[model samples]
Target: MRNLLVLGLALLLAGPASATEAEAWQALREGRAVLLLRHATAPGTGDPANFQLGDCRTQRNLNQAGREQAQRWGQLLRRQGIEHPRLLSSRWCRAQDTASAMGLGAVEPAPVLDSFFVQPRQGAERTRQLIEQINAQPRGVPLVLVSHQVNITALTGIFPASGEGLVLALPLSQPARVLGRIAPP
Candidate 1:
């Protein structure tokens, strides 16, 4: 298992989508990688002008499709062999909602996963912190970080669509290797 995961991480671009996602799933299931997921289809670009943390009304929230997508993510992951992951989410309402809707387990708010879109200046620092945190995660534990596109892009250089997931190997290096994209289910 370790050898396959290591090989997958080393040559992430060597295979097709299904093979890539399969290896990515193996890494995730074995606690050798993480799923950096963007929040589900919150129908809007950014938050309202008066957006504030901790208040759902102030932010652009998940639409019905987004909610269902999140639920489907839960079902898909469970079916793919991940039942209860250490779910961490940004403080945004949409992110929290996505995490909650997954029904996998409890959701913890990690500041590093917060969106820095409106506050671009914070991206470098937050990304650095997020990388450090991910590096510190126990090697044998699966984790799921629910965040925004900005955060995901900053860490992985992948502009993920809403509800999309990128599987990254554990102990991430300078340039993170995205093992695969976990398409919305």
Candidate 2:
């Protein structure tokens, strides 16, 4: 299985940028994988002090470039025939918008994926909870989590930029490992 994953990663990276989404989709379709997506290109750091959860105007929302990237990522998924994925996201507006722009399906607001960037340091407990969530999914179907940079970095050990994503193959009785990263087309 590991060998297969390495081959897949090689193929993905070898292909043109426009092929990233399809390669990622194929990987997800073939394994019990979890997709950890960094929020789209919101050109800023943390949210403001007065940021509200639901109100986009009050939060650090996605910019025009971010929105286009998000939509394009979704389009790529659709092009690759990925459907009915279980979508999850951080409570932050940027993460939520990134997931929503996929237009794939209902996205659950998962606090486990919330950014630890605001905290003095990273939160291990929250990251563990998220890992548990991914591990708890039933067999079959793919899981996608749209989250902040700190949260994704804590989980995957790789700091992905906005709109970038990691595909991790999770075995039923073993730990999960990163397969490859998917950059926007």
Candidate 3:
């Protein structure tokens, strides 16, 4: 099974940037994998100088297109058989907004999913904590984590685009087994 998963990852990495969402669905159907998603397109690059934890006004928020994109992602994910997934998000407004906007169930705040762009040093420890948590989670329904590019990259070594995601197999391997990428809706 591990070998087959590795082969899938190799094929996905070699394929086009247009990630096959079907591949992600197949991985998630096994019930032992999770999706790590980058928040939808927020206009600017990082947060503004006055970024705050719970204030959307103080952060780089999702544009109109991004909002629509999140809605479409919700529809698409539901269409793909992940109805009411256990969705988690970063405490940041943008990440939380993206997860909430998905309408994929309750959005739980996960501090480990917060971006480490400003404080690069915290990436490793936070990623470790996230991995520990994920590995410890009891498998059941589909799991989705809406996070920033920096945090997702730290976990899977893939710099995901806005709204893009990677399906990762669990137990927390050294280099994560990336089942496949789920492109933006």
Candidate 4:
């Protein structure tokens, strides 16, 4: 499609700083990075007024394109030799669906990855909790966390597009550093 081509061109034009895409993938494969990905395209900014976490109908579920995009991301990871990373997702339906579509192993619900759109004050708290969780993760184990835009921004200071991911180097003693981003073609 024209849109996908345009997106690919844009990503190629706006490539990651210093580190190339290959290096980013290598870092991920080596388990030296953590991937924080925004949920795939849901065709809306936020959930509806009567949103309920238990029901997918009440939430903004992913469209066909979104589902395909998630599958492609999974394939990309596999191609990069990251077959079965520790997958975590927010409790929201959209996030859950995106994680499942990744074809990765079982997805564990992480409250720390929950969106703070309605309640802004929780963003910082949840971000801190997520950082602590990342720091505690066992070394040499890759991690992929699927969350909302707000949560991702709160954690990494990067606003990624739908299905886009930011690779971070999370050191145990120091703060997490953004290494680069991965936008599948």
Write down the lDDT of every candidate, Cα atoms only: 0.90, 0.79, 0.84, 0.83
Ranking under lDDT, best-scoring first?
1, 3, 4, 2
* Model 1 worst lDDT run, 10 consecutive residues: 12-21
lDDT at 105, model 2: 93
Model 4 lDDT, residue 17, Cα: 49
Residue-by-residue lDDT tens digits, candidate 3, 1-185: 99999999988887764455456576685567898889998988888898887788888998888888888888988887888888988998878888988888889999878889999999888888998998888786788989998888887788888999888887766468887787898
Q: Could you tell me every candidate's TM-score relative to the true structure? A: 0.89, 0.81, 0.86, 0.85
Query: What shift in Å separates residue 97 of candidate 1 from its native position after superposition?
Result: 0.3
Q: What is the lDDT of residue 6 in candidate 3?
A: 100
Which candidate number maximizes TM-score?
A: 1
lDDT of 2 by residue, 109-180 (tens): 988888887783556777777778777778577778898877777766777888998888774122347766
Candidate 2 deviant stretches above 4 angstroms = 1-24, 120-122, 171-176
lDDT of 2: 0.79
- Report the number of the highest-lDDT candidate: 1
Report the lDDT of model 1 for residue 110: 91
Cα RMSDs of all predictions? 6.9, 6.8, 7.1, 6.7
**Best of the two (1, 3) by TM-score:** 1
Task: Say what the RMSD of model 3 is.
Answer: 7.1
